[model samples]
Target: MNQDERMFSIDVQSVNLAEYSSKGIVLDIGGGGEGIIGQLLGDKVVAIDPRSDELEEAAEGPLKIVMDARELKFLNKTFDEATSFFTLMYIEKQYHQKVFEEVYRVLKDDGEFTVWDVTIPPYPGGTKDIFLVPLEIELRGKKITTTYGVLWTKSGQDMNYYIQLGERVGFEVVKKEKNKQIYCIGFKKKTNAN
Candidate 1:
């Protein structure tokens, strides 16, 4: 699935987590003005991404914005729910564990982090054209891409590797599935399994 399709799945997964809402702060990592989960949210939501220019134009009240995901400027235990939809995969695998640790550190006790990212494409070793291409969008006095597809040059590892990595970082395997796509949510746990 492409970015748009993965986004739709993230929306669905986030919607399915509605039962866990409690007015706690939610942060969307790699969440560049996406995730309609905010529309259904009853709590505060934060969207953090590196694309400041593109998302700045779409920013408005309540839905706050940030410039980067790796270097989140929030204090510890400042969030209840954190998400990285179809995001962490694009991140360099070497820092994958660090990313999970940061997410784990920021969330409050018992907080949940939902991740919806692509694992393997349709074929074992094949490529699927991305859907979110760079489209020239007219916003304000500037032209920009309403759609973007940069993963074409990227190579993603197998899905199970991420699950194992999350576990290594002391996140409990709350829920995981591979439906039409790969989806998983890991809850903070007390101890690591070494």
Candidate 2:
């Protein structure tokens, strides 16, 4: 399927963005892909992605950076909030811990972090999650099949993994929401001194 026809959205509307809009700066990881979150949040957000080209599509107001999420360049306690939308699934699992740590480091005391991503059920029987599902589309009058699935299955992780990792990195899960295909989690950075 063409880019226009390709579906790409992770539900983050569950989080109360208006609160962050007035509180302080919010970091948006991978927003460069489509800039959907930045488009909605506007100047309150600064979006980052390693792919510079993708950032060109981001909405006008937010600051867009071509940087990797695993090692953010910002100084400690720089942001009041951070968010990742269906971004971790595309990154290798080995880097997830680092990404979480980076987010924690950049967030101010009492800062919040939110992530919305696909979930991998422990038991696959009734799951709507797809694994290499094939779709046939006509391109130039020729039929072509594209097999699509969540990226890096060998390194993909689940909601439980994130919750545990965040705890280890000084974040506490304050809220969680699950749907047939995805999970939305909100974590607040602990205030205790490390």
Q: Which candidate is the best by TM-score?
A: 2
Off by over 4 Å in 2: 1-22, 121-149
User: Best candidate, lDDT-wise?
Assistant: 2
- Record all residue pairs in model 1 with backbone atoms less than 3 Å apart, i.e. clashing: none
- Segments in model 1 whose C-alpha atoms lie over 4 Å from true places: 1-23, 57-61, 121-148, 152-155, 189-194
Residues 91-136 of candidate 2: C-alpha lDDT, one tens digit per residue: 7778889999999999998999988766544423322334432333
Q: How high is the lDDT of residue 6 in model 1?
A: 36
TM per model?
0.66, 0.74
What TM-score does candidate 1 reach?
A: 0.66
lDDT of 1 at 168: 80
Q: Over the stretch 1-194, how does candidate 1's per-residue lDDT look in tens digits?
A: 55445321111211134343435777877655543334335237687777776355434433657556667787877787887756775677677888888888888777778776654443223444442322232333333333333344244455577778878877877777664444555555443222
